[model samples]
Target: MDRRIDGLRVLACLMVVLLHVSSSHIHEFGPKWWSANVWDGLSRACVPLFFMLSGSTLLGRSESLTDFFRKRALRILPPLLLWSCFYLWWLWHNNAPTGNWLLAILRGPTMFHLWYFYAIAGLYLFMPVMRRFYQYSTQQEKIFFLVTWFLVASVYPTVQSLYTDVQCGRAGLLGDVYQLQYFGGYLGYLVLGAYLAERRIAWQKGAALFAVSSVGTILLTYWLSKRLGMPCEFFHLYLTPLVVLAAAGAFIAFLGQPAAPSSAGLQWLSGCTLGVYGLHPFVIDRLLISRGWMNSTGWVWIDPLIGTAAVFLVSLAVIGAIRLIKPLRWMV
Candidate 1:
C-alpha cells in the first residue's frame, strides 16, 4: 500500500474524531450557513472512507478468515469494550439510563460510536467469502452489484425517507447474514475503495469521478435545500448521491497527498486516534455539556460556523492526555 494512502487513512480517522467533536456540540457548528450543514454533512464521509479503505486494504491481502478475524478483532474490539465500560461508568455515575444491568453488559457502548465498531467487525467476519466472490466477478458484474448497492443503499432509502417521516435502519433476523446488508448503503464507499485500492480502477479516473461527482453533489444539495427547505443533512437518508460524492472526493483528495516521514508528534497523535474516537463522546456528553461551552454569540442569525475547530482541538487534547494514564495507556 502507498504511504500516501496510509496518510489518507490517518486523515479519515481524524475526520471521524473531529466529526464526533462537532456532533457533541451541535449548537456550535450547526447554525452556520455556508458551513452549517458542512461538517455533519461531510462527517458521514469519514467513517465511510474508513470502511472503503478497510475493504481495499484487507480484501486482497490473502489472509485466512480466521487470521483476518483475529487481526480485525484485536484492532477494533478491545478499544470498543474499553470505552463501552467508560460510557456505562459515566452513566452509572450520573444516575441516568444505563439500560438494565444485564442489557448494559450486552449492549456495551452507550453511545452511537459503538455501532461503527460493531458494523465493521460484522463485515470483517464475512469479507473473506465476499472477497472470493469479488475476485470472480467480471467488471460488468461488479458494476451491476454496485448499481443495486447504490439503489438499495442510497437512492431508494433517500427517496423513501424524503416521502415518509420515519427512520430506516438495518432489519433482519437476529442471526441473518443479510442483516449485514443494511450496511449496503455504506457498501458504495467500501466497494469503491476496494475497487480503487485493488488497482481495478485507474487513480486518475477515480479522482476525476470524485471531482465531478462532488461538484455535482454540492450543487444538487444546495439546490435541493433551497427548493425544499431541507437541511441537506444526512439523517433522513440511508445514503445520498451527495454523500457518496463528497466522501469519494474527500478520500481521493486526501490520498493525493504524499506522506511525510512520521515525526514522533504525528505518530503519537495517530496512535491516539482510536482513543480519541472512543472517549470523545464521553467528553462531549459530560464535560462539554456540563462546562457550558455552548456558543453564546448573537451572530448565529448570520449563520456562524462556530466550534468546528475548537471542539476538535479540545477533544484531541483530552484523548492525548489519556495516554498519560498509567493504567489505561495500553488502549490508546
Candidate 2:
C-alpha cells in the first residue's frame, strides 16, 4: 500500500468532517459565516480528492465484472442501505421533517453526505469500461480526454455564471452533438488520478498550486455569497474549475511527500474512514450541535475545528469498536 495514499485518506476524511461541522454556520450572516466559509471552502476538495483517489487505486486494476461488482458491493451497498435506514430512524427520532423514506432513498440518498455513495456507485458501475480505456489509451489520447472533460464538465458551467443567458441548446449541441458528454462527469478525475499516480510531481510545485487554488476558492466563494446576499455554493461545487484545480493540487501535493515511517495506527485510522464518514453526521447532529455543545465557543475558528475533531474521534472510536464484532463489520 502507498503510505502517502493512506495519509491522504486520513486528511480527506478529516476535511469531510470539517466540511459538515462548519456547514451549519455557513448560512448565518456575520463573522460566524465568514469563519465557516473559510473552513468549508478549504474542505470543498474532499469529494474530488476521494474520487481521484479511487481513480488512482481502482482504475489500474483488471477484474471480471462479477468480481468487480462483488468487491464494490461489499464495500458500498451494505453500508449505504444500513446508514440510510439509520439516518431515517435518526430523522424520525429528532422529529426532523421528511417524507416517504422509501421513495426518498430510491431517488437518492436519505442523507446529504450519503450522496457520495450514490455518485461513487455510478462511477463503479462504469469502471470496467473506464479501466479498459485507461489500459489501452495512449498518453496523448488520455490527455485529450481530460482536456475535453475539463472544458465541458468544468469550464462550461463556469461560463454559465458569466453568461446568464447561455443557452442550453448550445451546450446540448456541444455536449451531445460533439459526443463530449461521454468524457464528462467525475470520470475525468479517475483518469487524471491514474495518470498522476504513474508520474512524480515536485512537492514545491504541488504545494504552490494547492496554496493558490485554496486561497482563490475561499475568496471567490466569499465574494459570490456576499454579492448574492445569501450563502452560495457556486465555488463549493466539486466539478467547478477552481475546485477541480484545488482537488488536483491537493491530490498531487500529498502524494508527492516522502513516505512516513509505517505506523499501524495510521493504517487503522485510514481503514476506518468510510465508517467515520457514515457515522459523523449522527454525532454532529445528535451528540454535538443538538446538545448545544458545538459552535458554543465565541471563537469562530475554535468552534468548528473542535466540533470536527470531536465528531471524527467519536466516529472513529465507534467504527473501531464495531469493526471488532464479526457480524457488523461488513456494514461499515
Candidate 3:
C-alpha cells in the first residue's frame, strides 16, 4: 500500500469520527449547533474519500471472480457481522426494542453507520463486472461514463429540487426514457477515484482547488440550513456536485503529496482504521453521548473536540484489546 494512501485512510477515519461527534449535537440550537453543522459539512468528504480509495486500490486489479469474492468476504464480512451483533446487543442493553435480532441483522441492524458495510458489500459484488468494464473501456468511453454519471446522478437531483410540486418519482425522462439508473450512486466515486489516482496534479493547484470547494461546500450548507430552518439536505448528499468537488479536490491534494517517512505508530494506526471505523460510532453514540459526557463540560467550542478525541482513543483501545485475542483478531 502507498504510505500516502495509508495516511489518507487515517485522515478519513478521523474525519468520520469527528463527523459523528458533531452530528450527535446537530439538533441543538445556538453556537454549538452551528459549529456541529460546519464540522459535519466539512467531513462530508470522508465517506466519498473512502469510496475513492477503494477505487484506487481495487479497480483494474486482475483476479478471478471467485477469488475476489472470497478475499472481500473475508476482509469485510466478518467484521461487519461481528460488529452488527455487538451493536444490536448495545441497542437492547440501552432498552431500545430490538424486536428480532435475526431480522434486525438482515435489515442492516439499528445502528446507522453499519449501513456503509452493507453498501460496500454490494459494491464488492459488482466490482468484478466494473473491473472488466474498466479493462475494456477506452479513455473516451471512461470520460463519457463519468460525464453521464455527473449529469444524471449529481445534477438531476438538484434540478428536480428546484420545482417543489413536481412528482417525478422515478417516472421521469431521465429515469424512464434515458434509463439513467445504471450510471448513478457511489460507483461514480469509485471510478473517479481510479481515474484520479492514475493522473497527477501539482500540489499547489490541488490545494487551491480543495480549499475553494471545501469552503464553498461548508458555506453553502450553512446558508441552506439557515434558510430552511433545519439541517440542509442538499450539501451533505455524497453525490451533490459541491460535495463531489470537495471530495475530489481533497483526494487530489492527498494524491499529489509525497508519501511521508513510515512511522511504526502511524502504520499501526492506519492498519487499525477499519477497526476504528467499525467501532468508533459505538463509543461516540452510546458510551459518550448517551452518558452525557459530551454535554458535561458545557463548553460548546471545546466539548466536541474533547469528546471526539476521547471517542477515538477509547475506540482504538477497545479494538486493540480485541486484536489481542488470537481467534478474534481476524474478525476485527
Candidate 4:
C-alpha cells in the first residue's frame, strides 16, 4: 500500500469535513460568507482527488468482472444500504418531507453525500473494460482520448457558459463534428489518475504554478458569484478545468513527497475515513448547528475551525467504537 495515498485519503477526508462545516454557515452575509467561501473553494479538490486516487489504485489491477463486482459490493453496498435506512429514519424523525423513497434509494441515500457511492458503483461496473482499454492502448492513443475528453467536456461547456443565451443540452458544433458526448465525463479523471501514477513526470515549478492557479480559481469563483448574484458553482465542479488542474497538481505534489514511517495511528484514522465521511454531515447539520454548539461567535475563522475539528473528532470516536464490533464492522 502507498502510505502517500493513505495520507492523501486522510487529507481529502478532512477537507470534506471542513467543506461541509464551511457550507453550513455560508448563507451568512459579509465576513462570514467570505470566510466560508475561502474554505469551500479551497476544498473543491476533495472529491476530484478521491476519483483520481481511485484511478491510481484500482484502474490497472487484474481482476475478473465477477470478482470485481463481489469485492466492490462487499465494500460499498452494505454501507450504502445501512446509511440509506439511517438517513431515512433521521429524516422522518425531523419531519423532513421525502417525496419518494424508492426514487431516493435509486438515486442515492437520503443524505446528499451518499451519492458518491452510487457514482463509484457505476464506475466499478465499467472499470474492468476500461482497464482492458488501458492495457491495449498506445501512449498516443491515450493522449488522444484525454485531449478529446478535455476539449469536449471541460473547455467547450465553460466557454458556452459565458453566453447566457446558449441553451445547454444542445451539442452545437462540437456535437456535430463527432459523437463527443459519449466520450466525455469522469472517465477522463480515471485515465488521468492512472496516467499520472504510472508516469514519473518531472513537475519542476509545477507546485508554484498550481498554488497560483488555485488561488486564482478561488478568487474568480468568489468574484463571479458576487457579481452575478448567483452561485458560480461551475468553477468548483469536479469536471471543470480549473478543479481538474488543482486536483491533479495536488495528487502529483503528494506523490513526490517521501512517504512517512508507518504508524498504526495514521492507518486506523485512514481506515475510519469512510465512516467519518458518512456520519459528519449528521453531526454538522443535526448536532453541532442544531444544538447551537457551532455559531458565529463573531470570530469567522475560529468558529468554523473549532466546529470542523469537533465534528471530525466526534465522528472518528464513533466510527472507532463501531469498528470494534465484529458483525457491525462491515457497515462503516
Candidate 5:
C-alpha cells in the first residue's frame, strides 16, 4: 500500500500557492488585504518539503536502477516536456521569440521555471545511490553536507549582497552550492529526511520544531527585507535562512507521523494536490494577479488569500476534470 503522504503534499503545494499568490502585485477593493509575515515564512518551506518527501518516498531500494530511472523519467520528463512545449506556444503567440523554433522551445518558456522538474529528475536518478548513502553515511558526513549548504545557499547570499549589483563572477564548487540551497542544497536536507525515515521521528516534536524555526526565519526575513533594503533573492541570508528554517520545520512536521494510506481525507487531499500545482499558475497569473490587483487599500495579504482560494478552486476543478479524462487520468 502506498504510505500516502498527502497531508504534507497538500500543505506543501498550498505553501507554493501562498508564495505565488503573496508575491503577486495584485490588489482589489476588499478589506482582506493584509499580508502575514508568518505565512511568508511558512510558505518558504514548501519546496524543501517536496524534495525531502520525494527522498523519503522514492529512495527505497525496491527497484532496479533501470526501473527507477524509467519511472522517474516518465513522471517528470513528460510534464516538463509538455509544459515546455506549452510555454513555447505561449511565446510564439506573443511574438516574444522569432529565433529557431526548436531551440526557442527548449529555452524560452515560463515552463522553464518548472526547472524543479529537472532538479527532481536529477535527484531521482540518483535515488538508488542516495538511498544507499543514507543507509551508510556517518553523522560527520551529514554535518559536512549541511555545513556546505549553509556556506553556499545561506551564507553566500549575505556575503554577495555586500558587493551590491555585482553580476556573477567566479563560479566554483562553493558558488554552485551557494546558488540554490534547497533539497539539502547539497544533500543536507535530503540526508535529514532519509535519516528520519530510518529512525522514525515523532510527529509532535517535529511540529513544534517546525513552528519555532518558521517563526524565527520569518522574523529574520522581514527585518532584512523591510529594514536593510535587501531583496529576498535566493541565497540571501533572510530568504535562505527562512528556506532553511522552513525546510527543517517541514521535515520535523512531516516526518513526525508516518503517513499511512489509512486516512480518507489525506488520500483525498493528495489527489487534489497535483491539480493545485498544475492549474494554480493559470488563474493566479491570469485572473487574480493580472494587473493592478496589488493596488488594494493597504492590506497586502487580502489579495493573496483570495487568490489562493481562487487557485484552489481552479485546482479542484482541474483535478475533477482530469479524473474524468481517459488518457490524462493519472495527473490527478
Candidate 6:
C-alpha cells in the first residue's frame, strides 16, 4: 500500500471516531449542538474516503476471480462474521432484545457501524466485473459515467430534499426506465478512487477543494436543519455533492503529499484501524453509559473531543491485546 494511503486510513479511522462521538450530541439541541454538528459534518468524509481508498487499492489488481474471493474470504469474511456475532452478543448482554442470532447475522449488521462490513462485502462481489469494465473503458467514458453518477446519486437527492413538493414524476420515471440506480451508490466512489489514483493532483488544488467543500457542507447542513426545524442529515449523506467533493479532495491531498517511508508505528496503527472501528462503539458505550463520561467536563464542546480520543485509544489498546493472541489476530 502507498504510505500516504496508510496515512489516510489512520486519518479516516480517527474521523470515524470523531463522527460517532460528535453524533451523540446532534439531537441534544444543547449549547454545543452546532459545534458537534460541525465536527460531524467535517467527519462525514470518513466513509467515502475509506471507499475511495479501497477502490484505489483493489480495482487495479490483476488477480483472477477465484484468487480475489480466496483473499477476501480469508481476510474479510471471518472478521465480518465474528464481529457480527460479537456485536449481537453485546447487544443481547445489554438487554437490547436480539431476536435470533442466526437470523440477525443473516439479516445484516447487528450494530450500526457493522453496516460498513456488509457494504464492503457487497462491493467485493462486483469488483471483479467492475475491474473488467475499468480495464476496458476509455477515460472519456469513465468521466462521463462519473458525471452521470454524480448527477443521479448526489445532485438528485439534494434537489429532492430542497424542493420536497416539486414533483418530477416523469423525470423520475425516466430515470427508473434507464435504471439510473445502477450508476449510483458507493460503486462510483470505487471507480472514482481507481480513476483519481492514476492522476497526480497538486496539493494546493486538493487543499482548496477540501476547505471549500467542508465549509459548504457545514453551512448547508446548518441551513437545512434549521429550515426543517430538526437535525437534518441531507447534506451529511455520504453521496451528497459536498461530501463527494470533500472525500475526493481529501484523497487527492493525501496522494499529493511528498512520499516518505512509513514508520513501523504508523503501519501498525493502520493495520489496527479496522479493529479499532469494530470495537470503538462498544468502548464508547462503556465510557459514556458505564463510566458516565457523556458529560465528563460539563462542557459539551470539550466532552466529545475528550470522549473521541478516549474511545479511540481504548479501542486500539483492546485490539492490540487481541492481536497478541494467535488464533484471534486474523479477525482484527
Per-model CA lDDT versus the true structure: 0.61, 0.85, 0.80, 0.78, 0.61, 0.85
TM-scores, each model vs. reference? 0.76, 0.93, 0.92, 0.91, 0.78, 0.94
- Model 2 accuracy (lDDT, Cα): 0.85
Top-lDDT candidate index: 6
- Model 1, range 1-332, lDDT digits (tens) per residue? 36555566667766665565444323332445434344445455677777888777776667777888777777877777777777777778988877675477566447677777777776776788778867887878777777767666666556666566533333222115444364464555666776655443344654676556545554555666766665454441326765666666666665555535666666676666677667666665555456665444545322123443454566678777877896766665
Report the lDDT tens digits of candidate 6 across residue range 254-277: 988887878888888998999999
Query: Candidate 4 — which residues are off by over 4 angstroms?
Result: 25-29, 99-103, 165-177, 201-206, 259-261
Supply candidate 4's per-residue lDDT for 241.
74
Q: What tens digits encode model 3's per-residue C-alpha lDDT throughout 1-332?
A: 67768888888888899888878667655667777777777788899899999988999799888899999999888988888888888888889988888788888745888888888988888898899888789888889988888888777765676455433222245877877878877888889889888787766676677677777877877777788887654666677777788788888888888756657777778878889998998788777867978766887767777887898888889888888788988898
TM-score rank, highest first? 6, 2, 3, 4, 5, 1
Q: Which stretches of candidate 2 lie over 4 Å from their true place?
A: 96-102, 165-173, 259-262
What range of 10 consecutive residues in model 4 has the weakest lDDT sum?
164-173
Q: Compared to the true structure, candidate 3 yields what TM-score? A: 0.92
TM-score of 5: 0.78
Q: Which residue segments of model 5 deviate by more than 4 Å?
A: 1-4, 25-38, 98-101, 138-144, 147-186, 226-239, 262-265, 291-299
Candidates 3 and 5: which is better by TM-score? 3
Candidate 3, which ten residues in sequence have the lowest lDDT sum?
A: 162-171
Provide the clashing-pair count of each candidate structure. Answer: 2, 0, 0, 0, 16, 0
Q: Model 3 misses residue 57 by how many Å?
A: 0.4
Q: After superposition, how far is residue 193 of candidate 1 from its true place, in Å?
A: 1.1
- Per residue, candidate 4 scores C-alpha lDDT tens digits across 1-332 of 56778888888898899888887645545657777877777787888778888888888888788888898899999988888878888898889987677777886558989988888888887789888998889989889888887777777866776576443333346776776776666777888888877766545444655576578677877777788786555566666677777778877777766656547888888889989988999888766778887774758877878888899999999999999998988999
TM-score head-to-head 1 vs 5, winner: 5
Q: Write the per-residue lDDT of candidate 2 for residues 110-164, one digit (tens) a residue.
A: 8889999999999999999999989999999999888888888888857775457
